[model samples]
Target: MLAVIRERYRAHGFDEIETPVMEEYSRLHAGIGGDNEKLAYNVLKRGLDADAIRGAAGDPAALTDLGLRYDLTVPLARFYATNRGQLPSVFRSIQIAPVWRAERPQKGRYRQFVQCDIDIIGDASARAEAELAVATLDTLDALGLEGGSIRINDRRVLDWMLDSFGFTSDERPGVLITIDKLDKLGPDGIVAELRERGATAGAVDAFAAFLRRPTTLEYNPYGERQIRKALPDGAPDDIVAHLVGIGAAVAASRGSATELEGDIPLVFDPFLVRGMGYYTGTIFELAHPSVDYSLGGGGRYDGMIGRFLGQDVPAVGFSIGFERIVDLVSERTDAAAPAVVLVHDRDVPEGELLALKAALVREGSRVRLEQRTKNLKALLERAASDGYTAFATVAQGTTPASLEVKPLA
Candidate 1:
């Protein structure tokens, strides 16, 4: 699977690079990563005076200057900024590596896990978004996953929705954080949580009603009408156009042989508020019917790099949740049996045994060499249990001659 991901990403002209796992603590807490900042594993300051460390023990910030990265995107942003002159004007990058988070571990959620990401920095066109969506869907299709869907929503559209619902600018972030949990907490649960967070009952009721509306897909005139009605009279035209353009692009790409199209639905989901604080434009998630959680997600973050470089650099990225995809794929695929196992008598020459192993490997077979034991039957039984399908036994009298081979029962 990793090989397939590398091939797909490289085929799209994305150069694979790696960044350090630990970043400066201040860089990790730049207010763009949302909840992930709180989950960073802070590294304690080294080579400091013992007295100073004891004095700053109450305030960890003074003692910590580094932290384990929570995602690949932020580190990429920093990398691009520092290496801008060395990279192409429009940089497409692939980073497949592990990130750390100080979070509770669950079935598919872990503190340490690999993230498969492909990001295009310095491209502001909606085409970037379209290409990313298509490439990601194609990759999933190549992996034999079906009946999945990509639920897309623009952050501007979400902002408009919040404004239409009378949520103040100050209330927006808190409200968005609550809305992000809608999948786990149903509509009623969301409203209850909102009210608990000091939102007015009227606002909560209105938001709840809006959430109850059925999900809208592209090219649905009625759905567009609903969106228009829900948005303010003067909602930004560019945001609306960008949203329409993405939907059209995705719909058109569905016809291509590379994409799964009808089998994997791509629809507009107005209520999706991805938890990331950096998302500035279109946001999306890939989900499969068989999986309860999202398979992966990403979006545009136009302003993030500007924080470091003092100039805006448009970026869009998509990351597949490596652990979740692996889990699903593992469940669907059959375990492969070993090609062959080599059994040699105790008196068999070591040189002959090595020669036999090399010959089998040259034949493109996976071969394992084991010394014969008094419990020969038990050894073979164990090898069979370990998934070896065939066995070859070396004759004691042969230096580099014939051997006996048998298939496991």
Candidate 2:
């Protein structure tokens, strides 16, 4: 799964970069939330001596000084920090690697999984965000995933709504965390949950009502409230009209008759509430009608690299959950068993065997020659039992120079 995705991104002009699995504990804590940091697996150092190793076995937590990578994006930022001068102005990369998270293993979630990520750095425009959507659509199309919609929203818009209701930055994460559940728990359920969490009734009700309202906001280069202020009373009809116009523009530009809108559905779902703190402008999720959880998601993070470089380098990207994609592909397509052919040519000249193998390969047959030499009848029987379509005999061709090809059936 990771290899396929990595190749696809690489073909699309992305350079493959690798980051250290073992990171300094302080470096790993940069910008990540408390819960995410807690999920990291600390790389504990064991003492060299046998006695020390045995003594430290009972209290191994004290010996750890580093942590495994929680996600690839942060480490990429760190890499950019050290090697920024050596990199190009507009950077594109794909990282397909394992990340560890100490979470209770459940459906679609795991302790260790591979994240297939593609990111473009050093740009700050709505078109960059739109390209994230386009790349995501392209990737899913390549994978043959069906009935998935890319839901999009801006974190700035969410921030505006939160601040408009008098919520501070400190309160914003918690509020966004709950509002993240507006879909799972309906308005009433969310209101109840907020109240249970000790939010005032007015704040909860106002927040709930605001969230339940039309999610489409005018993509204001300035801000959402300013866009509303330009309009009379910030009517939902006007906001929706702006959204429809922008969404249409997005569709017309990215979606031709082929890449999207037929098997893979792309819709403007403004209600998508991606809870990552790093996302700045546009955030999105890919949801399937058959699967309850999102297949994967990503968004724009303009400030992420800024924190590391001391200068803002806008970027947008997404990670595909490779395991989920494999499962989906397995369920969606009828899989065929591969044919295996065992070869008994260990003592035979290598060049002759390779030539025989190449001849069969050129005929468009899925032929694999096993190198182990065994009794000819046993090899033939095993090849038949292993579901081979055909078998070939490669030898010195003494007396007769012609080749013998036998159907396994």
Candidate 3:
């Protein structure tokens, strides 16, 4: 699967690059990750710094100078900033690596997991969003996951919705955070949380009405249509055009790949307030029909790179939830069996054994060589259980030509 991902990204002109696993503590705590900042595993100051921390200080900020990276996006931004002069004006990058978080571990959630991300920096056109969405969906289709849906919503749409409800600038952030929990809490739960967070009864009522409206459109199963009916009276024209353009691009791209056409649903979901604080424009999430949670998500962050370089760099990215996708794929696919297992007697000549192993490998066979055990039956039984389909035995003075392959029961 990783090979497939590498091929897909490289095929699209994204060069793979790796950034340090640990970044400066201040960078990790930059508030760009939203709630993820609170989950960072701060590295304690070491040596003399540790001694100073132990002696005095009301806050630990001085004691912590570094932290494990919470995500690949931030590190990539920093990398691009430090090496911008050497890199292409329009940089497309692929980063597949592990990130750490101190959050609670669950079935699909973990303290340490891999993230597969591809980002295009320097392209502000809606074409960047469309290409990213199409390429990622194609990768999923290549992996045999066809019954999934892509839900997209622009941050501007959320801004318009909040303004329509008369939410003040100071109040909008808190309200957006609550709305992000709509999937887990439901509409009633969101309203309750909002009221508890100081939203007025009228504001809560208005927000609830917006969610209940039949605005969310599923483009694949249901046909395509204008989303203007769902927007507020004065929703920005550019935002509406962006959504329509994305839908059309995805639809047009599907023409050449008929087998995968309509197999993956695409929808416009207004309530998808992806928890990241850096998302400035379009945001999207991928969900499988059989699963209740998102497989992964990403969006445009035109302002994020500028925080590092002091100049705006438009960017869009998509991440595959590595652990969750692997979990789902494992459940549906059978484990592959090894082609052959070579069982050699301890007294067998080392040179002959090496020759046999090398010969099998040269023929492109998956092979494992193990010293023959006194309990040969038990050894073969264990190998068979571990998905070895065939075995070859080496005798005390056997020549490579004398060995015969035996099929496992």
Candidate 4:
């Protein structure tokens, strides 16, 4: 799955780049990571004496110099800022690596997992967004994932919409938190949550009025009318138009037989407030019906780079939750380069086996040499499960030319 995603990203002109698994503790906690910051694993500072350790209670972060990265985007921001002069004005990078998060162990949640991410730096325009969405959809299709769709929204639009609703600046954050729960809590639950949180009475009442309207937000793939219906009158036209353009561009590029809608696979979700607080503009989540959770998500963070580089750079990224998607994607079945196993009797000389295996390896075959065991059937079944497509039996007198390879049943 990683290979397919990485190569698909590379094929789309995204250069594969690697960042250190550990970054400065301060960088990880710089508030951009959203809730992930609290989950980062801090590496204890070396050689802390009893007094130093005792003093650290006052400033726990001071006790750690570096920490495991919770996600790739924050590290990528630092990487771009450091390497900006040497990189292209519009840099496309692919990061597929493990990230650590200290989560309470549960099904589908782990302390460690892999993330497959592709980010575009330096292009703030919708083109960067379009490229990311298209590339991600293409990569999903390449992974044989069906019924994938992208849910998109803009933070700026959320702000504008909130302002229009009379939500004070102080009330917006808590309001967004409640809004993010719309799918889980429903319209009535959202209103209840806001009221429980003591949101300004007028704002909560106004929002509830909109939610209870007859033209409630319904799920659709994408369109101007669909978007307008989702929001009250006078939603920002520029942001609305930008989202419409993104949907059109991605739809025109997709050739899926399993599109979410009859036409496109992009959903303009006006309330998609992704968890990341750094997201300044467009935010999106990739969804598939097989799972209730999103497969992945990302958004534009035009201000993050400037915090480190002293100048802001336009950037956006999309990531695939590899641990979640791995189970969803079955082993690839491409027969172009099938794996072969050499089942050999103990009598076969190591030199002869090596010569045969080396020959097969040079000919572009993944050759695994397994000694014949008593449970031949079980061995063959295991090999089949491991993705070995064909096998050949070899013994003392066997030669490469004389080998008979048969497809595994």
Highest-lDDT candidate: 4
User: What tens digits encode model 3's per-residue C-alpha lDDT throughout 245-352?
Assistant: 776667667773322244435677777889888999999998888788898999999899898999999999989988878866542323343478899888888888
TM-score attained by model 3: 0.90
Least accurate 10 contiguous residues by lDDT in model 1: 256-265
Against the true structure, what is each candidate's TM-score? 0.86, 0.75, 0.90, 0.94
Q: Please write out the lDDT profile of model 2 over residues 211-275, one tens digit for every residue.
A: 55765564433223333543324335444343334344455565543223322244444446675
The clash number for model 3 is: 0
* CA RMSD per model (angstroms): 3.7, 6.3, 3.2, 2.7
Stretches off by above 4 angstroms in model 3 are 49-51, 55-57, 212-226, 256-264, 331-338, 384-387, 397-400
Q: In candidate 4, which residue ranges exceed 4 Å CA deviation?
A: 216-221, 252-262
Q: Give the TM-score of candidate 2.
A: 0.75
Mind sharing the TM-score for model 1?
Answer: 0.86
Q: Which regions in candidate 2 have their CA more than 4 angstroms from the true location?
A: 1-4, 45-63, 210-249, 255-271, 331-340, 345-355, 358-367, 371-390, 393-409
lDDT of 1 by residue, 180-293 (tens): 888789888999899999976677878887767675554543124434554546667787677656655666676633223333266667778888889998899989889788
lDDT against the true structure, each candidate: 0.81, 0.67, 0.82, 0.88
lDDT, model 3: 0.82
Q: Model 3, residue 283: what's the lDDT? A: 96
RMSD of 2: 6.3
| lDDT of model 3, residue 326 | 80
